[model samples]
Target: MAKYHRIIMNGESYYREYRYGSDSYGEMLSEEELVHMLLEEVVDEEIEISEREIESALRRIPDREDRYLLQNYIRCLERVGRE
Candidate 1:
């Protein structure tokens, strides 16, 4: 059986299957997850991404473990005075 999760988009709500792409190396339905992972790597690299871009992506994600992880990441940046 497949599982699903509720997430928000454009102020509305929708039920999404987080593992819809599992047949493809555990890929999932959350584009945000993939992008978030990429950004996570970026955060550890020499790449430079604007805070606005990070926040904009953050707003697209609903409250979940990954979201919170990313949030905490940004919070750490803030604590270190990112701006």
Candidate 2:
């Protein structure tokens, strides 16, 4: 038998238990939190885009603020499985 627990941090729920003898698991998150985490961790340059591509794209986007705003939107779309 096993027991599991959960906790919320920064407005997101996280599991506090682990299951042995398996290689699968799942969790849940609010849209806001999911977007934040995915932007911060899940989707980094190493995940898909190469450094050269990122550099090229960065050069094409002139405004720093606009670039950042677009990046945030991209993260949101990715988290929602649209990208």
lDDT (Cα, 0-100) at 10 in candidate 2? 77
Give the alpha carbon lDDT tens digit for every residue of 37-81 in model 2.
657764556546575886578679989998888788867867998
Backbone clashes in model 2, listed as residue pairs: none
Model 1 TM-score, 2 decimals = 0.32
Q: What tens digits encode model 1's per-residue C-alpha lDDT throughout 46-77? A: 76879799888988898778788999987887
Error of 2 at 15 (Å): 41
lDDT score at residue 23, model 1, on the 0-100 scale: 37
The C-alpha TM-scores of every prediction are 0.32, 0.30
Native RMSD of candidate 1 (Å): 18.6
Best TM-score among the predictions, by candidate number:
1
Best by lDDT: 1
